[model samples]
Target chain A: MREAYHEQLNQLADHLAGMCGMVADAMELATKALLDADLAIAEQVISDDAKVDEARSVCEEQAYALLALQAPVATDLRTVLAAIHAAESLERMGDLALHVAKAARRRHPQPVLPEPVKPYFAEMGRVALKLAHQAEQVIHTKDIDQARALEDADDEMDDLHRHLFTVIMDKDWPHGVASAVDVTLLGRFYERFADHAVSVAKRVVFVVTGRMPGSGDEEL
Target chain B: MREAYHEQLNQLADHLAGMCGMVADAMELATKALLDADLAIAEQVISDDAKVDEARSVCEEQAYALLALQAPVATDLRTVLAAIHAAESLERMGDLALHVAKAARRRHPQPVLPEPVKPYFAEMGRVALKLAHQAEQVIHTKDIDQARALEDADDEMDDLHRHLFTVIMDKDWPHGVASAVDVTLLGRFYERFADHAVSVAKRVVFVVTGRMPGSGDEEL
Candidate 1:
């Protein structure tokens, strides 16, 4: 029974890693769709979200079943719990990617981004994809140092997010209110996507060190 | 042991309902701060969020303990799991309210909403607070009917959100990019708060009916 529980735990981790990969692909495709104005890729990313949702449900069910049957305690319990949360964070990352796709689709035929803010989004997209890949690695390795590094990557995303505002707030911004709203929401989507990745990394940190990363509190 | 488990479940429900009230209050104050430019109210809402976080952690710990020690199955398992999810949704709602407050604080003496968009935000705030109260009611009663009704309330919020965009997109829109960006994020914050409330309601629907609300699929 103990061996079976360990096997199930490993399976949960594997499932989480798979989810991370799916999200990374979704974000990459969504970013391309946003930049290139490719409706086909945008639609694909939007539709592919259902698969990520399915993956999350599968991971959640396995965790619940493990709890009901084996009732593993201590670090085992934390691992299962962390798996549930990490899956959720990954699922949300997929949803953020979907939002990006939908935005891309909404402004189809016409490019959503104006010229001045284009470079900022391009960099944001690059940072987002990099973070997504790192998020996957954090899940697979459960390395505390890598998990901390993910937070730094997320900080870069936040800086890029702030830079977007500076451009919009400048006197020369000629895109007007509609484009500003689009840019604001787009920057937010990428920033939030990175936030969820950091959250997944924090869960990994919790599993390995028995401490919540951001709060640095041992009790949680 | 069965009765003890049942008692803990009831306590968890009670705790979740309490969180709902706190979140409702937080949203109200945050909205007031945004509309009135009241820094003190914004600060209060921001500070009160810590209490909400503490409440969520307590609820989660209790749910985890129940899963580990009691190993509830079937409907009982679903209820505990739903409580965990509902608590998370509620906690996120609190965070959204905090974001609203932070935005309000950042703008300080100046009102975030311009004259033309003020009414839309006012209406959004009203709908948000109303939905938060309804969310609390649904948790306390677990009325599947009311749970479904909350979705309609959420639909109203979506409408209000769309209206903000229409106002911004209009040729007559006088606000510059800065205000437009602020309005976009503010609208999104309210929309997401309602979305989380609707998610909590759906979880209640799941617990009562053994079916997920949106998809009607038992697989989740």
Candidate 2:
């Protein structure tokens, strides 16, 4: 029974990693759509959201089943719990990507971004993709160092978000109210996407260490 | 051993209920501060956030210990997991109240809100406080009906948020940039506060039902 439970647990991890991979692809494609003004890709990201949603549901079910059938203890219990939390975070990340795609579709005929802002969005996308990949690694191998690195990466995204806001508030940008709202919402999406990635990393930390990061040290 | 675990689990539930009660108080005080522009009360809300944070850490620790030591299965596992998630949602609710209070403090000495918007702020606050109370009840008793009511109440908050935005956008309001930003952030805070309450209710539903809300009978 213990061996079977272990197999089931491994299967849950596999499903979570798969979901993370899809979310990463969605983030990459969504940003590409935003930067290139590709309507088809944007539409694809929007349409593909249902798959992410489905994956989230499946991951939750598998994790719950393991808890129910196996009655996971200690580290095993933490692993199952973390899988559920990570899946939820990944789903939200996918939703944020879809939001970016929707914004891209709305601004299709002309690019809303000023040239100076392009690099920020590109860098934000790069960091987000990297975080998602790192999250997948955490799920597969439970790599504590990789999870810690993802947390550090989130700070860079925050800096980039601040830069985007500074540019928006600059006097030289002739963009009107519509552009201002678009950029503000876009920055919010990137920030929130990074936030969710950080949340996944925190879950990883909890799974391995049995305590949330940044709280006083307590032995597992 | 099972009896001992049950005792610890019950104690954890009690601590969670205590936290919920404190959070409800904070929300009420924060709302009053916002509606009345009472700086002292706003300051109190900000100061009380540390208590909320401390309570959250304690509850998280207790819940993790229960999971690790008890190795609860089936319904027992669901209960502990739901508690952890509910604690998080409640902690975020406290943070949202602090945010509203901080905004109120920044706009002190003079009212940030115009007289016309006072009624909406009052209504929003009332609903937020009521939802927080309902979430507390749900936590204490595992009451599904009250939880469902809280879910329904979220719609009203959403309506008020939309109304607030409409008022801000109206040309008759003579809105300055600072006021617009203030109102927008306030509206978002109320919306998100209600969202956290809804999340708490969803967790209650999951705890009782052993499946996620909106699963639609889908297989894993």
TM-score versus the correct structure, for each prediction: 0.96, 0.85
Alpha carbon lDDT at A154, candidate 2: 82
Cα lDDT, model 2, residue A112: 56
Which stretches of model 2 miss by more than 4 angstroms? A36-38, A105-119, A170-174, A215-220, B1-7, B32-40, B105-118, B170-179, B215-220
DockQ of each: 0.55, 0.28
Per-residue lDDT value at B109 in model 2: 77
Per-residue alpha-carbon lDDT of model 2 for A1-220, expressed as tens digits? 9999989988888888888889899999999998989999999998998999999888877887887777777788778877877887888788888888888887796775766788999999999898888888888877788888876788888888878777776655565434555666677778778877878878878877877787311100
lDDT of 2 by residue, B35-96 (tens): 88999999999999889889988987888788777778777888887888778777878888
Residue-level lDDT of model 1, residues A69-172, one tens digit each, is: 88777789888888888887888888888888998999998889997788888888888888888888988888889988987788788888887889888878
- CA error at residue B73 for candidate 2, angstroms: 2.7
Q: What local distance difference test score does each model get? A: 0.86, 0.79
Q: Candidate 2's error at B58, in angstroms?
A: 2.6
Best candidate according to DockQ: 1
Which parts of model 1 are misplaced by more than 4 Å?
A215-220, B215-220
